[model samples]
Target: MLKRRTRDFHQLSPVANALFHVIAASLAIIAVFPFLFVLIISFTDENTLARNGYRLIPEKWSVDAYHYIFQTGDSLLRSYGVTLFVTIVGTLISLCIITLYAYAISRKSFKYRGFFSFIAFFTMLFNGGLVPTYIVVTQLLDMKDSIWALIMPMAVNAFYIMIMRTFFSTMVPDAIIESGRIDGAGEFQTFIRLVLPLSLPGIATIALFSTLGYWNDWFNALLYIDNPDLVPLQSMLMRIENSMQFILQNSNNASLSSGILQNMPQDTSRMAMVVLATGPIILAYPFFQRYFVQGLTIGAVKE
Candidate 1:
């Protein structure tokens, strides 16, 4: 009777189930509100925003924010292309390096797993200072103004590698690996043909992380890029916004201040920039959501 009662306790009453969904739905709305507000503000008229402050429903609507961004469509297009290329290439390379390193360390038979694992963990604690790293990239490698500079800097993160290793160590079955060896499959072959198919959730999690990192990166471009054509979208937006901020900050002359203020696209354009920069990356989350959840949860509780 006690065992039966224990089993019955696992099931929730109808009121409890309804309460769970209500809480979940409220949390979801809270999560979605910031993005929706930014989007709504982007469509709001500059005058209306200045007059009324922020609102879910604006008194006046305008496409002026988009119009401001689209003023130089060619530059915008070029930046978008550069961002896309960097994100795709960087995420792929990061995943390759991370997964292989993770898989190697996960194997008990590997001779130097401890050494390599130490190296990976050590990175999380410390780093070469920025000035020296900058000199290496700029003076030694001479990658200034090159897209490779952007791609290489953030290619692999140690924390991410550790997560992947944890996933591989805990989730992959030992018997499956032994079976692969029994079938005369080499390390690389087994990894590609067998391991990857089973490790989709973990791979997808890192891929999503890397994708967001690359797509949102601008500091690398700011440091290395001198070529106008190679600027990524985030950097491009930063430049535009920074220029406006500079003007506003230094406008000691009232004549100049009035002239600039009269013609400026206003806060709507800033919100529009946020919307434009973030929209594509946010859309990608849904595709990876299932795998990402599994990967995070599976390794969270270790046996």
Candidate 2:
């Protein structure tokens, strides 16, 4: 059996390898520490936090934060469902639209490729603004308060389309497309069967991008959705935080009771809600982890 040879330039010497690992580990810790701190603070008792300020290990531990968040189980679960549906459905639709647009612009044979490309670029530079966009979706289209409100507003991202166009133009070979045509496959068939499978790195990149966009979006729900059932997880979480802040702010007023304020889990519960809302999305990253780097690098330096 032959041993696999590594390129000498790419291979790091022992001390260099150790240094590289050290730097990577330090960066990883820098990225992870804030989230870890948030988790620890969520378990820290509100009294401990008030008395001592933030600490890695609090004088006391409690789950009141989590308890406060989950106290409304039905509302939490319903919001979770709404968010999941929007993210999944929106990501799928957005990926399809972005890929098709990118592919169309990538093909040299397409007569109006330059015109379409100009349109995509134009969108990236300018928009109708929020007021006009809101009017179009709500008054003009009459989709206000619908689930479509959450999904359609951000369905197409121009930046993503550009990334995808770069991938298709520089990475996918013209000969392969021509060969597919020679084999009796139409343009749509070639794209669906051949191009898409070959372009998974780029497709996965767009999928991850769209998934993160849809899952993290709360502003769309805030603007267009008035129906409680259509509210997303992040928006619901914001509402809870706002309510707690309002109650805390007014607690000292003559009309309010100090005892009730003292009992409320404001800081810790907000932290806990942050944890709950972000945990699933963070977990979802592993599915896209493999393709992320590959997709970003392909055709990045193409002529």
Computed on alpha carbons, the lDDT of every model, listed in order, comes to 0.89, 0.88
Residue 243, candidate 1: C-alpha displacement in angstroms: 1.4
lDDT, candidate 2, equals: 0.88
Tens-digit lDDT string for candidate 1 (163-254): 98998887788876887899999999989876777788989989999999999999998889999999999999998898778777777866
Alpha carbon lDDT at 44, candidate 2: 93
Task: Assess the local accuracy of residue 106 in candidate 2 as a C-alpha lDDT between 0 and 100.
Answer: 93
TM-scores of the models, in the given order?
0.89, 0.90
Clashing pairs in 2: none
Off by over 4 Å in 1: 1-13, 250-260, 293-303
Supply the global lDDT for candidate 1.
Answer: 0.89
Alpha carbon deviation, residue 42, candidate 2 (Å) = 0.8
**99-190 in candidate 2: lDDT tens per residue?**
99999999999999999999999998899999999999999989989999999888999999999999998788887798799999999999
Ten-residue stretch with the least lDDT total in model 2: 294-303
TM-score of the candidate numbered 2?
A: 0.90
What 10-residue stretch in candidate 1 is worst by lDDT? 294-303
